[model samples]
Target: MSKILNEFLSSNLQELKDNGLYNEINVVRGANGPVIDIDGKELINLSSNNYLGLATDETLKQAAKDTIDSHGVGAGAVRTINGTLDVHVELEETLAEFKGTEAAVAFQSGFNCNMAAIQAVMNKEDAILSDELNHASIIDGCRLSRAKIIRVNHSDMDDLRQKAKEATESGQYKKVMYITDGVFSMDGDVAKLPEIVEIAKEFDLITYVDDAHGSGVMGKGAGTVKHFGLEKEVDIQMGTLSKAIGVVGGYIAGTKELADYLKVAARPFLFSTSLTPGDTKAINEAVKMLMASTELHDQLWENGDYLKKGLKSLGFNIGNSETPITPCIIGDEKTTQAFSKRLMEEGVYAKSIVFPTVPRGTGRVRNMPTAAHTKEMLDEALEIYEKVGKELNVIS
Candidate 1:
């Protein structure tokens, strides 16, 4: 490599190491379940996004296996060309129904949905009022759209209203839109969608919700929008098939017009290879299961409440999360990393998250208690947490 490139890489790498911002990847030896094997050690896994534990469901697995045998693996090409398989059409239909929308379009991944849908709708001539703490995918999608982005404070309806008024009345843009995550992953706070929709109605602004972390976790598995009964009010709803759906892909659910427009305009759907048949089939089955019952969803909440109560009682700052995603806040970055390391050593596998993912000095070890996690597993994990916390002087 050239001298400049080497210097740039060396300095950045050293800085991350010095600041406790460097992420160490752990390899899961088997299926990512409530308990996972890492480095020959059995650990109570609390770092996954599998809220309902459908990722390892035998039903989903069987669906994928069956489809792979019948349709082969890949979708063969991009959807616009020849990849619009029968399963693809079926999955989108299921997704649209799940979202309570008129139509839906699937993408290869959740990240791609934002990258495609945002730019396809908004442009430089428009302005996007986004939540200050939205996922990075939303941030990047806004930038790619070339729209004037105005940041609204986290869940602050007043701030959203003020920004909405300014953007819509400024006359500096042709159209304005408000976008936010249905659930903020880091803090696990639900967005104030009702108030946001009210504001949008007042200003005639478009509304979009990136429900990547909410689907199958909120709205009795329908999503946050449905959770609030705003399915018909919200214009665009984007969700992941991977997270709670327990598969691999994303979708944009909205009116038939929006879906039709995106089918023609979204570059990722035009260029990238489509989601494989197996994943599509599996995702379809998963959604169907959720519609059939809320057994997993109820169990997930039970585990989350148990874990949060345990941590809070132990004197850890378990933030004001309203979802199964819990964060044990340890302010200092280095200490947070050390805390997580100690937890790992004691048989729990919660990982530390620091700068960039969350604000500086608010580093945390995010714990995801899923439906697959038993009361016994949570009790064991909590016990380990208490021991680690006291040992590390994180709790009295």
Candidate 2:
């Protein structure tokens, strides 16, 4: 109610509007899948993270319904108190097995998991070498740890080695950790885990990989750490169930000792209520499905290849992507936003990612093709892209 606070907020919001950075959120009127309904328009959804398209799977839905009937809707207390239900423990066990880790712990969301896990392990006395293009969650986690953060150039082994050697040689901290995203969401590029593992060993640095986008996409659906066979090498592996698993939670998979330590020390784990029984059960089923079958994973790759090739054929700049995530590089923020708006208007829904989310001038419209999208649907989407691309003069 303070006039000063109102004025400050208004000024900041106005700045966003003036700069074409203020985004109006669209309401998804139907279920989220490879296609969705936004503002009464049916659009081929290429911006969702449901990589395996398990979010709307009948099996997962049934599992959630059954669990809700049996366990009710919520875990009524914080995990440390009484919220840790059997389903939660089961999911943790399943996740540990899936990730090839000794143990695992779940949190309310991937963002909170990053905040809790990073802060729990790295204190002010510790130093962290972070990848320059790591996720915002990783950046926030590093900040929360209060560590001496040294950002190595993205995917540059030389830079990482130099920083690691310098930090370790200086001996200014109790522990040194290196953190990166296993698969960058924007570019869909896999992290150089082999190089990172070697550096971590040489410097005796703790390794942390946030595989939010890599889970159920890389390593035949296990993750990037598993893709590179670094499960035993990396110290901490974090992932989100909300994306590929079609549920709402996050987890950190690591050694039993590390998981135990997080259970006691991580603020989000200790203070936040545990995931609902329905979510926990659905996630368990989703993990089981991923481990048991590769159908969805294959379909996801097919869709990704189809979409990427189609975009390329239309003369749109699809960046170097090795995973399901595809980016149509637009360079400028305003142009990127305009491009996205035009796509939506043309009945395709892909979001524009700009400054802060990504580096300035590297603005792009990121597309996430899931297993649920049919070939015909992708063809239709590509046609729309061609139409919009020409209209925007992005392509001939």
Candidate 3:
């Protein structure tokens, strides 16, 4: 708009382009299932977070459509302003039951859930000990809380223990909290919850675990907190209905007092419009599915293992991943982007992660294998991977 603003944007744009950091957005034309259509080409979609492939499930779709018929569309107002629908109450109850918590409160999205819950609990007089590799939402939440942030090494229990001990012994804050992702998204590593819980017990620090990527993928789909049997120990359990739940919302599961406090004090909950009735109903159905069976979860893991083995056999570095998320480490940013482009040309759509999304020189092509993927589909994708890997010199 303004000349100065235009110049500023141009400068940054040129810098990104010169450094091979600029990214081009692609239009996904069809449903984001195990396979997706991008630019009129079908591809084995390996870039989605839909771990269980429930996003397009008939059950969830029907539930959403049925709810829409009964409750119209939007929530009309914020939760505090008479916008809380019966579906919202039902979803919250379902979430609480799923997470084995006394109460649960839902938000518009996972990012906002972190922003709301963290600030509602921690304050200026408090201190936070966080994992270095925690999700961006956790970082923003800690920052929003205005707590003295102390970053511990990623998944390093020793560092966490030391920091927790120091923060508590200093007596410089009224309260201290240790926060981490239940599963690190990029690297596909699980958090050391058992050790973290022990440290929290020792220091009496409030515990927070953001299970955005862990819900419906861990604990037979209950989440990482349940995976580690720390359901009651972890003070705050944050998760998303967007990922594995195949809906659009986030929630905080904890004690009744904590949920009550968030409902009253969290700015997003108090000011933002509540989730749609369709989303609420769909998420309730998703949770019920997970509670009833583990078919999808098992299928997802099998697909992940198959893809990882296939990639590894082709001489591509799949990185150290213990979950369904697989990353083919390509190192340089340009090479990573180029490889992703080549894969797209071959009708395999996998996104490249570089720089800001990951650390420098650690760029990768992350793959998410969902339950809906058939064995034949994965085998075909692996053949494409082999061709691309060889062409790009990523494999011999």
Candidate 4:
């Protein structure tokens, strides 16, 4: 490697370490579940996004195995080419039905979906009104679109309405779009979708919602759009198969015309390889499970409530979360990370979120409670949390 590049890497990494922003990745010995083993120690895991716990479900595992046996390991080509298999078509169909949309299209990952979807629909002449706290993928997507992006305050309906009205009335752009997260990941808050849709209608702006964290967790697992009964009204709905779906991919659900347009216009779908057969099969089965019953969904919320109540009872600031995602706010970055480290030492695996991932000085330890966690497991985790919180002076 060049000397200049080596020096650049070393300096940047050192800077991260000095600022307490460096992440030390823990290796999981096996499948990610409610309980995970790390470096010879088994811990109660509360850091995963496996809300419904289908990641290691027997049915999904079998579906993946069967697909691999029949279709081999790879998709063979990009989606625009021969990579589009019957299983892929079936998955899209299932997604469309599950989302209550006219059609849908899948991508290699949620990030790719955002990149492709935004650029496909918007260009230099368009304007995008995006939520300030939307996912990094959405921010990157807006940047990639080359459209003028106006950031609206997080979940501030008045800000969104004002921005939407201004963007539309200015008449400087061919089209205006408002994009937001259906569920804010860090804070565990649901987006104001109903109000957003109403504003979009009043301003005649295109509406998009990234429901990555909402799918399989809200509206009996149909997601936040359906939770607010705006499935048919929102112009574009994007979701991930990786999170609650317990598989790995992302998709855009919309009208048949939008799907058709994206098929030809989305560069990532045209250029990158499609999802593997096993993943597609597992995703399809996961969606089927969500459509079949609400048992897992209910359990996930129960676990979330249990953990949240336990943390709050201990005097930890859990924040205002409306979903299963819980955050134990610690305020200071180093203290927050130290709190997480102490929890791991006490046999609970949770991670700390700080500056960049969240606003500075508002550090938090985010906990994800899944359906797979047993009552016994949660009880043990809570006990560890209590001990660690008290020891760290995060709780009395």
lDDT of each: 0.94, 0.92, 0.92, 0.93
Model 1 ranges with Cα > 4 A deviation: none
Candidate 4: worst-modelled 10 consecutive residues by lDDT: 15-24
Displacement of residue 162 (Cα, Å) in model 4 is 1.2
Query: Over 4 Å off in model 4, which ranges?
Result: none
Mind giving the per-residue lDDT tens digits that candidate 1 earns over 227-275? 9999999999999999888888999999999999999999999999999
lDDT of 2 by residue, 1-396 (tens): 999999999999999877767777889987898779987789999999988889999999999999999999999999989998999999999999999999999899999999999999999999999998999899999999999999999899999999888999997999999999999998989999998999889989999999999999999999999999999999999999999988889999999999999999999988888899998999999999999999999999998999999899889888889898999999988999999999999889999988778887998999999999999989998998989889888888
TM-score of 3: 0.99
**Model 4 lDDT per residue over 1-396, tens place:** 999999999999999788877788999999999999999999999999988999999999999999999999999999887999999999999999999999999999999999999999999999999999999999999999999999999999999889888888998999999999999999999998888888888999899999999999999999999999998899999999999999899999999999999999999999999999999999999999999999999999999999889888888898999998999999888898898999999899999999889998999999999999998998998899889888888888
lDDT of 3 at 90: 94
lDDT of 1: 0.94
